[model samples]
Target: MDHDQINNQSRGAEGKDTKADGAAVAPQFSRDAVFPGEVVGEVTDLNRQDLEKQKAAQGSAHFHRLGWKRLTVVLIVEAIALGSLSLPAAFATLGMVPGVILCISLGLIAIYTSDVVGQVKLKFPHVSHYADAGQLMMGRFGYELVGAMFALQLTFLVSSHTLTGAIAFGNITNNGACSIVFAVVSAIILLILAIPPSFAEVAILGYIDFVSIILAIGITMIATGINKDSITTAPWSAWPQDGLTFAEAFIAITNIVFAYSFAICQFSFMDEMHTPSDYKKSIWALGLIEIFIYTLTGALIYAFVGQEVQSPALLSAGHTISKVAFGVGLPVIFISGSINTTVVGRYIHGRMYKDSIIRFINTKMGWITWLTLITVITVLAFIIAEAIPFFSELLSISSSLFISGFTFYFPAMMWFMLIREGSPFATHNLWKTALNGLCFVIGMIVLVCGTYASIVEIAHKFKTGAISSPFTCAALA
Candidate 1:
């Protein structure tokens, strides 16, 4: 599964630039793997064979190319996309005290688990994706298991964005167009924007997505803050009202977790860094930013709007603010969806083509193949988005089924397995072992209980007709 074995259709112009000759060259493969299962290209300092060193010498611009700033923006956008929107509603459901506590606590836990991923990569520099980490611990089965889980997680994420993007469109248009039309429109946009061959190529556009969300939320905050007098809000009730249940609250908790469920991405990000040491800086920077944003945004919005605050919290605004905010947020929903789609696409492209990705990137047929995958993925996401339009329910189910594994379970396994591998003869460190065990148990609880809660909630929504049916003209707005 090396470059030579793949269809090197454009093999003649091996080392030349496609633009210089106006012909796609055979990719001069790079030794710098951006994590094996994830998107790749950059050069690495690590030693390999002489052949690889030659390949590294000739790699294109896309490989191992990200610096700390670009990496930070990418990570922040991924975390902030769909998950950050629900924090206000989470606060409303769990009360300000518990909600803030969860926001800080979970954000910290997410950082710790992210650090665990970094450590795992440090130990096994070749590890590329979640499956690569899994394979290190349990061979082929582990690789497939973890790989499929993450692929599914990314797919679920893309679908969630599709649903949310359509909602955002509806929210902006006052439900003028059918949501299904918006979904298709959003899907087309994602496919076109995701044409870049690697995440590194997309890094430059990260700021646009980030700005879109900031303006969107900032507008909502300003609009709501100005009209505080008219807003009706509940006193912080210690528990749910008679009709609303704790299941609803946990779903909110799951939403916050969903916001921080970024462990699955650490591998890909780390692989692209020019200096691996900068990764610690990236994680800490991300954690601090999220803590401030999540707590402040959630508390302020919830305090003003109280228990009736919508999941996105944007929707709880006055009609004008809601429309303006969602319209402003347009780039984020689409950008975030495209990023996730590319992550899924990268994993598949790497698996199918292995080390031949650079060659794939250099060919016209390769771009066609990539576009085809993107089109197919968007179609799938569209169908799912239409079928389950409830935002919180979709987030919760994704969280329960995969978030825990991505953020907690996989990291703990990496920690424990790495420790044992480094010191096979030494007695296991009791305190470290206990801590990892605790993390694993917590992850399992969230996965099992949270999944049951989300499914039950989705079922209830269906039975009560609280959500729209597939392809309906009814406003999901």
Candidate 2:
């Protein structure tokens, strides 16, 4: 059968016909077909139909309202954040040429992997999250494993933002309060912003989040350019640092990898798209935007500040301008951070109430559970942020361990196991197979080498008393 025929049969088997009251009326799939491990079961279709009914009943609670533009906005909210700020430091380590090359090349690879993810989602509409895709690829074991990774990675993302927020507050207020207090305030703001569970609703905040980061980065660039002459006259290099170690280099590379990890949440976001096929538009838009922003931010900031550039290039902008940049960037930090909580909350909420209208979050009970879940997520993230009171290492470790799978290897595997149409050795599929092989290799390399580098560096920092004690009031330098 053709692809469309297969899809039609699949849908028909899973009860495409539903009553107005959201009851499944069509014949169910055979037990053998449903449990064959190649497709999702009938229960998922019922849940989906039920969700549609709930969405229709609660008009404003609809989840499938995102268009391509809004999809891009939501992705930007997820992808671009403190990661951009860290690029300058990455650039400083790898030097100008490699930094720019990695920024462009890795971005292209990420775009390809994201396209594969979107294709899988379109093919299997029931795959609402990465974990669901995992189930399709590797059964129940895959489901649980990917689900845990999804939750932890998103929580790690939120924790990174929490850390960024505290740092921003500390810098903006010039250390006026204890760092722990700043962290608590940051967690509260994140919790509040994450209350809206819908991706469409979050996309609204994405506009402000995007503009906030852009203006902040723009201010930093202008400030740094103006102050370059008066600042340190250390010359920037076009090549890697003279004595960069393996650990140092991989840490920098992993930071760049971390920056392109929008793919990790693409499945979740695309699930909310009104036209899922329009994902290509959003993917290209986000990919180009990230490439431009990261390359420019890394190169310009590194050139201006040379080796003295901070991880967050904002601090490289003169003392006064750094504070201003942080002030302007608060929205992106909190809004972006909160969205992670929302994604995780949505996933958990959907799983917890798959058969109930409460998953839609339009009722009293839904709101209560959602609020409680997000609060718990935010608190856990805050604790993690304190436990790892540093920036670059946390990002590198998260990227190496999780983003490697989600962005690179997992999508590559998806293309091979779920999206490919024929044998790998077929003439038509030769180049694509090779490309996916390369992607898998790259992901594995990052997973192994990058993790080792991050751990080694972090351990060294701790051994040398370079990192502050967790939950300390000491100001971040």
lDDT of 2 by residue, 116-223 (tens): 999999899999899999999999999999999999999988888887898899998889999889989999999999998899989999999999999999998999
lDDT of each: 0.75, 0.88
Off by over 4 Å in 2: 1-61, 388-395
**Any residue pairs clashing in model 2, and if so which?**
none
**Number of backbone collisions per candidate, in order?**
5, 0
Checking candidate 1 for backbone clashes, the offending pairs are 35-128, 36-128, 41-63, 42-63, 42-64
TM-score of 2: 0.87
Q: What tens digits encode model 1's per-residue C-alpha lDDT throughout 190-275?
A: 87777775667777778998888788778877776776667756544544455657678678778787788767887877776777
